[model samples]
Every structure is written in structure tokens, then in C-alpha cells.
Target chain A: MQETIEKVTKVVKKKRAKFPESYIHDIARAAERHDLDDDELDELVRRVKRAYERAKVEKGEAVGTVAAQSVGEPGTQMTMRTFHYAGVAELNVTLGLPRLIEIVDARKKISTPTMAIYFEDEFKNDEEFVRTIANKIGKSNVNDILQDFHVNFAEMNVVAELDETKIKDKRLDFTDIINRVEKAFKKAQIDNNILSFVPSKSNIRELRLLADKVRDLQISGVKNIGKVVIRKEEDEWVIHTEGSNLGAVLKMEGVDKVRTTTNDIHEVEKVLGIEAARNAIIHEAQRTMDEQGLTVDVRHIMLVADMMTADGSVKSIGRHGISGEKASVLARASFEETGKHLLRASIRGEIDHLTGIIENIIIGQPIPLGTGSVGVVMKHK
Target chain B: MKHEMVPDHAVLSKSESNKVLKKMDIHLEQLPKIKSDDPVAKSIGAKEGDILEITRKSSTAGKFITYRLVKD
Candidate 1:
């Protein structure tokens, strides 16, 4: 009730118009079918009128004061009879439905508040009364209400394209999933065209394999390559000039100053071809999944690997690639020193706390820390 | 009389019950108002100001109570 009042007051202040109580009374009918008692109804009108009065004062024009909620399109909703099925009881609820015509955007929603009251199932064993109630709600609405359990579909976002090829892993492709979704929509005759393609079990397995292959650089380009180093102090940052007469190291923009002790030829080759490696990773990942005849989008593979990889040197799906979040603690413990304290804390921390007792004995009398503050404590529950 | 005009589903509603009683050549003081809070109106899915026709299949002799919705 307060919310409605505030809403009305705000809208009235915005529009700045004045209308008679009857006019305000009419607008308040939007929620009239909510079955509010007289007091609630009166309160709603009072708030609406107050809104108009406020608008009038703010705008300094009595006649021009108007609230945003216009009078009477009442949205074609009318009071009706309904049976609301809840947990264990079926309530014979008086309902109001918006029966008017309007177009709602796929992005928009209209909320209609409702209240259900439980009453005796007087119609029990009374088929005629039951039929009357059903008929009044209409067959179409009944059908809609019955089939309300069907799930919805969401739109798809394509990340990578998969080409049919050979690989070590098998998974379904994305396009194929999209095809299945579109076909489902068509078959179901659902009005919504949007759908979310949830990854299935097989899809996840293939995606994992793809992540491993791409990170290893068995094919495609080098995408997972980290920091590069060069051999000859002069060739470190510079592109390799020892090629079949290509632009060579120093000639490539910003490559002239590479000073490295790590083999310059391989260093420059890897540096100049980082993109090729990344693409190669992408290609391999795609092939791994594609080999299984799965048409999954390549983006998922890339996301998994990128999210998993912290350091490229340790190319692994277990901790380095996909399970990285859980793998770190395990890796540090297994590869390095394990903490006895941590293990003890994990095992007996709760038991230790529970065992420690602090009680007042009065001297041992159990005089405790708060012993001097006996009468200072007051608690109310 | 109103019930005669309406379908068999019509009853002196919570709101219209008094009016119906008056039409039957009786006064609100004479016939029952079927208090707005009566369990009967709830059973027919009628609220204040709404009317419904109920048929009492086996109870109270009457086939049903076509009552108006009221706040009592």
C-alpha cells in the first residue's frame, strides 16, 4: 500500500496535473481487481489524489497538475473465477487477467500482482460447476495453463568454427547443436526463437581434449606461447634475418634491439610466429573435438585453456589448463613440502575448539575473565 | 428474479444478495445477507461486488447459492 502511494505521488509530481477525486479513483482501478479491502482501496485513491495535489503545488498550476498514470484503459482486465493449484490445496481464487491487446517486446515484461484465497471445494463431486469454472477461463487459456511446463530456449553465441578433420578427441560441433535447437523450436512450435545451447557431457569431454591438443601446439599456430628469449645478444628481440631473404630480424618494427643469449634463431622464429602458434593451438583444439564428429564452437576450448593456463611452461589440462583452480594446492603439496600444521588444522581445529571449556567456578570458584562484570550483562531473547 | 434472469450459475451475490432478497418480495432484515465473509462466496470464487450462481448438490436443500461478493 505504501509503495503504491509513493509510486502515485512520484508520478503525479512528475506530470503536474490536477484531476478530481473521481478521476484519481478511476486510475487507482488498475489494481482494483487485486481484491483489496475498502480501506486499501480508499488509501490508494487518497495517495493518487495527494499526488495530484502535490503536483499542483510544485507546478504552481492547479488545472495543469496531472499524474503520469492516465485514467481508464483499464487494460481490459476484469474479475473472474479461477482455481489456483498450489502445494496440497487447490484454491478457488477470484482472479483478474489483462485481456486487452498489446505488444510486448521480447525484452520487456508486464507484472500483474495477484492474491489467491482458499475456499471450500464446494464444487467437489459437482461436475457441472467444475465445467462452468473451466469453461469461463476458456479452453485456450486452459491449454496454455496446462502446457506451461515446457522449457524455454536461449540464443547462441558462436566463438569458433570447426572444420571436419582428424584428431585424438571426439565431440559434437556447435553448428550441429544449433541445428538441433532450431529443429526443436520448429517441432515444438514455440514462439521464441532464442535458445541457450547448454553443453552436454560428450561436448565437455571433446572440449577438454581440444584444450590439451591446442595448448601442446601439435597443429594450428602457437597461441599458448609465453615470454620469448633470444640466443645471440643482438638477435634477442629482433626478428631472425637469416631467412630466405625475408625482412629479417632488425628490419621488423621494434625488433632491432633484441639482445639475448638464448639461441637467437629459435627465439626469433618463435617470437615472429607467436600468432601462427596461437592459431595453431586453435586449429589443434578444433581438430581434437572435430575428429569426434562434434561440431562444437572453438571458443569453449580456448576459454577453458586460457582460463586454466597460468604458466605456459606447464602445459596441462589437469592443473595447468582446466582444473587449475583445484590443482594449485595439490601441486604445491605433492611437489614441495607439505605443512603438518595445515593438515592438523584441517583435521582437529573444530575438535580442539569444542574441547576447550571456559566456565566460572567461583575460585577455583571458576572465576573467569568476566567475573567482575557479573551484574553488567543483560540479554533479551 | 435476478437468478431467473441469469444462468443457473447465478446466486444472490455477496453484493447482490440483499438486492435479490428484496426482489423476492423480502427485506434485507427478513432474508440472510449471506455475509460477505461467508464461506459460500469463497467457494464460488467471488469476491466483493462480484456475483456467482452456485448449486448445492447435496447440502442445505438448495441446489446452490448464487451470492454476491461483499465485505460484510
Candidate 2:
């Protein structure tokens, strides 16, 4: 024990010798300003340095004295964002500063955390390669991780990455948006000419098939808002589209099965083909507006949902979504109890469940929180 | 190969040598393995059934490796 203590002391002394004189001066200044005694300051510095040393073993910014004070900020709120992957329809997700911090931290080191991530859109999906990248990133050594995954942590912009991840989506709640663009247009001194044309009822199925093509619009692909017209041009079956993929429209007009579009951007051609998803969001928002007594339009919902889900993959809104387990549990608690109750519960213990304990049995068919039977109360008078 | 002691206990076995090398981020291939029948063994005047000790980190820890030349 004495030998071990001596050895540990030697190591500590060596480490303290490496600590810059400037650091000690800074600590001394803060201590004097804060009215903390010099002895207390020295002890605090030693503790912080120990923590910093421990932190250096992991992948992140070293948890120094400054980091120890600013662990987490309470009373902060989160906003939603959208991100698109491989140019599929937008998938929405909730985002905030915490989420931003996560992205910044993730990008701090070259290696990223990996899950059983499923790539949704086309751009040559390599599940195996991506999984390999995930596994490599999960390791300790950043040098090894970067070499294995080919990522440069030093070059990454943490703030920009946070902004991109947390604020990428432009999705609005249905209740939060105006239901129609006419009011917005009126406010902005502009009007969109609605050129109405009635198509024949015999080709309704064909129109639906053509509408299915809207999902393939990518960053490199043509962008078009479609308006289908079925007016006969010289006795021919003319299925004309106003501001959509002319190629997609032509393919549907002349064929039976709908074919995918190629990567091309011609002049004065199709606008971004987000109409079907846009319409779906609009209709859902309209329903919410009606239910919630809101006057918001489908477009705003589309924009918000689009912002949230601009990424090709649609993350679910429930506990299973991208947020951490603590946040998810908090979200679940909000449904069971009041928001304040949940906050109180959170503060009562540092973890989501401090007092929450496991039980072996219950009154009803016990819904176990862990593996076996969980206990629910049945208090008798 | 001759200078390399073929230990009676085989303390520095093939796998053990490789494992030590691995901890140092190297391989046995990176180390100069002595032959069992090299003339340097005769020069050191080491006979068969004699023990040869190779110190590593410290003598007390026995992280220091030794071999017994018990082979013909």
C-alpha cells in the first residue's frame, strides 16, 4: 500500500509539473475574485485536473475546470428541424441546443456513434460499409477511427454541423400554420395564377400513377409543382402537367408501369416534385387544425414537416425516435402527468427515475419495466 | 536459430512471444529471432539443460522472460 501510494504521488507530481503556470494563475485570480480561500482553490484545481485527465481517456473535449461548472443548462427548450438523406421525401425530427451539442460532440472526433442505421433513399446504399464505419467510430482511439472511416475531425465545423442537424427541417405543426397561401400571397403582394383544367374520369388511375413519380425528385433532379390537365389536344389522350417532370409525365402518358426518372436538370422544366408529400402533410395539418381549432394551412405544416423530415428518412415521433432515452422517458411522463410534475420528477433525482424502483409482482397481470413482473399499486381503503 | 534456447518449460513459446510483441504494437516478425543452433550459443559457452534469462520491465515481476536450453 505504501509503495502504491508513493508511485501514485510520483505520477501526480509529474502531471502537476506539466500543468501550465498560466492555468494556476487563472485559477488563483478566479479564487480571489470569488472570495474562495487559496487552500480551497488548490483542492478544486486538483479535483478538476483529475477529472480532465480521466476525460482525456475518452473521445471529446477535455472536461477541464471550466467544463465542470457548466454541466447542463436547465429551462432551455428544443425546436424541430428537417434533414433529407439520399433525396427521398423529407423526414422530420425534433431539434434543440442539446441536440446541437450532441452533433458538435459527435463531430468533435472523426469517428461517429453507430446504430443499426437503415439507409432509406437510393444513392447506392451500402449498409455493410456504413455499419463498418459505425463500428470503427465506436472505438476509443480517434486516430484509428479516422483512419478506418476516412474522416477528418479537425476540419469539421461543430456549430455549422449543429445548425444543420438541429435546424435543418422547416416543418410546422398543422395548428401553427395558415391553411392556404392566398392570405400569405395577399400579405406579400403576389398572386399564384390557378389555371384550372378538368381531366377525364376514365384516366383517374393514370393520374394517381403519375403522381407516384413525385417522390424521386432529388437535389440533382428537376423541381416541379404539378397541376394535371386532361383536355384533348387534337383528339389525342393529352395528360399535360403544369410545372412538373415532363419526362415523368411523358413516360406515364405513353406507358403502363411508372418508371423512375434519371438525374437531369433542363431549362424552364419541372419544379421540385414534393407535391404528393406536401399534399399529405397539408391534409394531415388541415385535420389537426380542425381538431385543435387552428386556422393554420397545410402548406405551413408541409414546410414544418418538410423541415423536420427534409431528410429522406422519416423518424417516428414517439419514444423510439432519435432523442436520448432520458428525453424520451420525459416525453412519456408528460402524457402520464403534468409537465411540471415531470420536471419535478426529473429534478427529484438526476436520472429520469431516481425513486423509480423495480418490483417482482403486481395486482393486475404485471407489466414489467424490466424482465419479470412489475408492481402497480392497488391501495384498498 | 541455434542461439535460441529451446526451453525445457518452453517459457518463451511461439504464442507468448507473439503476445508480448502485440502489446508493444509490433509482431514477432519485427523482432530478430535467434536460431537454436547458432555459434553464438557456443561463444556464450552455454551448454544444453542450462537456463537463459531475458529481463523485460523488471526482475521481480518476472515480466522478465527466461528460457531453459534442455534440447539436444
- Number of backbone collisions per candidate, in order? 64, 45
lDDT of each: 0.30, 0.31
Quote the lDDT for A294 in model 1: 43
| Reference-based TM-score of each model | 0.15, 0.16
- Across A50-90, the per-residue lDDT of candidate 2 in tens digits comes to 76667443433223322222322220322233221211222
For every prediction, compared with the true complex, DockQ reads 0.01, 0.01
Show where candidate 1 strays beyond 4 Å.
A1-269, A272-276, A308-314, A319-381, B1-72
For model 2 chain A, give the 10-residue run with minimal summed lDDT.
A157-166
Candidate 2 segments whose C-alpha is farther than 4 A from its true place: A1-250, A253-280, A283-295, A298-304, A307-311, A316-328, A336-381, B1-72
Q: Find the candidate with the highest TM-score and give its number.
A: 2
